[model samples]
Target chain A: MQVYVDGIGILGPGFAGWPASRAVLAGEAPWPGGETEEPSAAILPPNERRRSSALVRWAMHVAEEAIRHADHDPRALATVFASSGGETGVLDQICRSLASPERVLSPTLFHHSVHNAAAGYWGIATGAQHSSTSLSCYDSSFGSGLLEAAAYAEVEQAPVLLVAYDLPPPPSLFPARPLTAGFAVALVLCDRPSRRNLARLKFHLEDVLRDAPDTLADPGIEALRGGNPAARALPLLTAIARRRSSGVRLDYFEEQCLSIEVSPCPP
Target chain B: MVAMTGKIMAPLWISHYTVVTALGRGLDSTFAALRARRSGLRPCDFEDAGLNTYIGRVEGLEDLPITGAELMPFDCRNNRLALLGLRQDGFEEAARAAARRYGAGRIAVILGTSTSGINETEHAYRDRDQDSGVLPAAFLTRYRYTHNTFSLAHFVRSYLGLRGPAAVISTACSSSAKVFASAARFLASGLCDAAIVGGVDSLCLTTLYGFSALDLSSAGPCCPWDEARDGLSLGEAAGFALLERIARTTDSGAVALYGYGESCDGYHMSHPHPEGLGAILAMRGALARAGIKPEAIDYINLHGTATPTNDRVEDLAVNSVFGTATPCSSTKGWTGHTLGAAGITEAVIALLCLTHGFLPETLNTTRPDPALAIRVLIENQERPLGRVLSNIFGFGGNNCSLIFGGL
Candidate 1:
């Protein structure tokens, strides 16, 4: 059975998501259910004054977008947050302290630095009872996460939420050609079957594409804006979220090994 | 593309163990802590810190820098954990031998980390406001995001001297667990004769404040399965497992990866489905893959983070499958949730259990959740067991389960 990406939210370099991603998906109709626009960059809720890392802020926005897009109540869904680099902003702070013998890794960045932090934030924000998972597949992050999530949905016969986001690394440390700054993504997956859904995912051991520009895509809005792998869920989710209620289908793929087929229903 | 597909060619082997956590620097100290049931839980102690929270801290990486420091440059705390973890469980030997056989090119080193080297990179940034075309003469490159994690692979590759398919699996909590599956797939597919797969995550401020902001960090030691379990006590650890072709082992240890299953629930952004559906799929997948019946398993090593949601859902998942009768335990109590390191650390423990034929206790369960259908081993038990199961459930609804059986 192929899993359909029921709902999605992709936050990129700019934009709160729904509208931006919808345009990219080339949707046939306006977002079926209409969209809610929020302050794009705020980390915590509008009422909450907590300062958050760039990653957390981006994650929060995407998470909210994904929850709403899925048409599922915030309290009802499960989630998975994947990142090759989790909250790079916070990590940079700790590294600074390491250089000084007197300064030490801050206790806050220390704990938030774990891969599970994003999920922790989402769990808390929504007061959701769903289990949250986090993953890092390096260059293959987008592909690995998609395959794993799809596999779970197939076996478990339940909806699975998968999010993959990565912030561009700050300078003065390691050097890389890609500048992956200010990007984040969020996803909601359920086991419900829909006929008008996108393509379903299939897994295989394919050779690494040595020549491909990039192997994996972030599933967040940033990926959609940048046009990447995990971000593919954006257009599909955008199409579904717009619909007041209808069976729609879309497919999310990576490394060509696995594909998640999402089919969202009318609310 | 696996070379051999019939009858699942061979079982996965677990040949090494290395741990660096708040409990202690190496495997021995961790074992000691476990036996004494000494919790590594401690309040956030960094006074110069940005956030206040509890964490399981690993001491002494500052003056320690890197041994064979000449080969690796740009000291990131991440690499330090690697060096420390490798020193334990006689892991260095396995790493050294791989280097010799694979010419440092054929042997690949895979790492699982939630946050790779962001700490070091951040340190350099605080020293400078801009990247001036020229790097500090003494400073090392490769600390960049594109390179740091990958470089760490090479750093370890050069450290242990392994020469094949060196890469990092940054799949958050599932990072390390995925390493095992990748290594197994590679070996069975004839990609490599031997591979080192594990996770290394160090405590950093970002995680602390980040988790704190989420309101998930426990003010006290994490209580897995305990009714009062509030949240997790963050810890840093580097764990490695030397996986070889199943047929290559001559040792007395019967620890081998019998089966593995992984899945993602696209349910929401952060929470796991209340039913533990993804988790159940993973566990079921592993059992099927290993060709072992659920009842045949003697012990289960859970990915219990002691979080309010994870505990309850995991309990339901266990009950749905194994029924509360099976012996199971969450070791997070002894070793704070090591995040990326949790998978491999738990893998090593799973291997150890199969060898010792004993089920360890869940450290801080004051009272097992009444809803739990499986026997949550509150106290360590000695018993002969042929098969053991290890479960790692991560943030993306990313769940992976591996069942290990005797040789």
Candidate 2:
């Protein structure tokens, strides 16, 4: 199946926004080093702003950037939010509270720990009553969510926003699945081509053993992709930024991968 | 809400489905219990962390052994229930047959769960080392496949030895119901020929206490749509369904998935839209995709958590869409609120209604809310039905409605 990517949003260590990251992906600018500043999600109301967690802010940050870049009304597009381990910080807090003698938990923390917490915030932020789905597949979350969003856009013939984000678990659970830093990537996919299209992606499901994802030339970017599942889109993002057609294979499961051939479209 | 008015897609077949809830292990017991209107809920008796609420805890999970050597690492309550669910009614055999018919690489596994292996983590937290303050080595070793949300899919894929695209949707309560929509997309995209979709959520302290913290747990058996309804009774369940393209299936009595619609409330994180605006949109979307009218629906499996707000909002939505004529009931009273697994558990019930030809009564709901305009069935009515709609809504305003009918 073929889908058009009209816009992209990315956030990770050393990369604050899509424009800066696009420059880095294009090798036109030095890779920003060190921790990136997290967004406050000031767009949300004061009540929600106080409740918005790091993961929710990261999700909304990219989603807003992508929708803004695509110039698509957020309300008109369906959404798919994918994360490997959702809000492990909140999970750890709750687990600690549960194990503690108090056995009491903050209601806000309890609700935020849900897998769809970020998606909920997104709906409130944009008032997008369109279909929204939150899913996860461990390390293969990005590939699974992309396929879901792409297929939905194709079937419904409407624009769909695909947001994939993941933050490292707290120190307690970090050893189980460690990550270098937080990562998020968003793609505004449409069934039909538009003037704002960045590139056209043609996807096919291949029945083959999972292959290691392509590494970025920059060690900083490569480390991010290697550690976080959502950053797995870096290779494709690089290709799109370079305005070059490339084939990228994303891990799906044990013996299956989603192969996508990207063709850059003229601005 | 406007009707979908879009091109109707070909229907998908529900070739096989099974459920393991507080009721029983397989369809026979589950159906029998539902027919008897028996409540699976009992006073809370899970692990410590005291809370006075009824719970529908599945029996014998601790004793349920993971038989496969390869699946040992993924062994946990959730996966055990998933394995037990797969073993029931020869679901594994049917899945194997599907893999053979459509190559193992062509069948997808899409399951839903709110917290896959958090129970293992919770237990691990309790067993942390005294001085080190680190989780036990055994826990770390088991964490890879056991604690991950995708572990359910991973375990199922490995157990069946299938290599198809697999994913786990985790939108809290509506997780499993949305998997049907995901499976349909895979089929439509030609990504997979047959898909194994369902949900498995085991009881854990996190959910129990979390719901208690939210004050959404009911002290008594949940009575959805009841005038005295208070809150939901938490439950643990594992439900699976095999979906195949209608053109490829020749199985008799296979229930057809006519349409599915998903939407977000854009209203609130925990609370549903007061008037169920999202619910109406989803129901309308499903009917539009199915190319059917609201009056055509025979019954609705309401997402009645029995919470005052939930039942009231859902009633408003159903009344606005299907009006007061169509019968609707909340099976949650029978199985308790299964969270992520509620979607498939209830979907299975809707399908069973097609086979058994009886509209299940809203168990435990003695006095229906008089203010509600929709028909809330209190008695199991014998009625031959053709089409049914199952609604599953979750936190984050995630709402999904599925239409199932006789082929």
lDDT of each: 0.62, 0.88
Q: Stretches of candidate 1 above 4 Å error?
A: A1-267, B1-9, B50-53, B67-70, B101-104, B125-142, B145-147
List TM-score per model, in order.
0.65, 0.97
lDDT of 1 by residue, B125-243 (tens): 44554447333434444544222444456567656645355456654677788777656655654445677888888776556655666677888778888878888878878888787
Interface RMSD of each: 8.5, 1.8
For model 2, how does the per-residue alpha-carbon lDDT over B1-407 read when each residue is reduced to its tens digit? 42342558789988998999999999999999988888899999997758889999999998987866777899899999999999999899999999999998889899999999899898888788867779888888788789788889989998998888888899989999999989998898888999999999989999899998899988899999899999999999999999999886466677889999888899898999998999998998899889999989999999999999999999999999888999999998888999999999999999989988989999999999897778989999987898999999889899999999999
- In Å, residue B352's CA in model 1 sits off its true spot by 2.0
What TM-score number comes out for model 2?
0.97
What is the fraction of true interface contacts found in candidate 2?
Answer: 0.75
Candidate 2's residue-wise lDDT over A1-267, tens digit each? 889998888888867777888888889999877886877666577788777888988888888889989999888888999999888889888878877788888998888998889889988988888788888888889988888898898988889999999998888898888888899989999999879899998876554335555657788778787889898888888888888888877766544556788899973
Correct interface contacts retained, every candidate: 0.16, 0.75
